[model samples]
Target: MTAVAAGSYPTAPGYNVNVRSGPGTQYRVVRTLPRGARVTINCQKPGQAVTGPYGTTNIWDNIGVGEYVSDAYVRTGSDGYVTGRCG
Candidate 1:
């Protein structure tokens, strides 16, 4: 699993933005992040979590999904979260 600290941009296209209670697949569906949403990776863990109200969250990272996005999916630097399309 990749170790991405909080404040890192997602490197995958059309990545499933599954909202969790904490930060894993185990948590309930807080919401799903739309494609190109600027996500600030927070933490990383091994395997999914299975014990809380959801299940097992793991093999992923956490982040604070931005509220609104502009036409700038590409992340050049860590200034803030951005989403759109990259050339």
Candidate 2:
């Protein structure tokens, strides 16, 4: 996992977000994050655009190996990438 000094971002309140194996929803869901969960974004990559509590975006945050969550569901205080792009 990549280390990001930006800290962690919170998931949309009251919603349990899905963590996919890839950057997009087309990928298999590896797990579901509980509501009010906070995640540290290791890296980000372009993926399927999704509209969530935060807004619409195509950015996906990699929280763990093979685990990604839509940026639209994460409150990162920015509508842009908060960390380095995934290699």
Candidate 3:
């Protein structure tokens, strides 16, 4: 598994990504990040399995303290170890 860095800015490629309260769609929607939005990945972990224009992945990126958006809609340039793991 790769870590999405704490300050790395990953972009949303296709449409808007739903920023959720947690790492899955089961969580409430905190906001919607427009396409091309630079998301600051605070940490990353495997959560819900999500598929988007990019593909399917279990990697969920923490954008803020509790704000999470799936890696499915986020292009982090690499598939692994872009940042540290969440506690």
Tell me, by TM-score, which candidate is best.
2
Model 1 spans > 4 angstroms off:
1-6, 49-58, 64-87
How far off is residue 75 in model 1, in Å? 11
lDDT of 1 by residue, 1-87 (tens): 996444545433555445555533445666666665566544333434333222222233444342221112224243232222221
Clashes of 2: 0
- Of candidate 2, the 10-residue stretch with the lowest lDDT total is 2-11
**CA shift at 54, candidate 1, in angstroms?**
23
Backbone clash count for every predicted candidate, in the order shown? 15, 0, 6
Q: Where does candidate 2 stray beyond 4 Å?
A: 1-6
* Shift of residue 67 alpha carbon in model 2, Å: 0.3
Residues 1-87, model 3: lDDT tens digits: 996445656565568778988878899998888877888787898889998876888888988878988887887877764787889
Model 2 agreement with the true structure over 5-86: per-residue lDDT tens digits: 8668889999999999998989999999999999999999999999999999999999999999999999999999998999
- What does the lDDT come to for candidate 2? 0.94
Q: Rate the local accuracy (lDDT) of all candidates.
A: 0.39, 0.94, 0.80
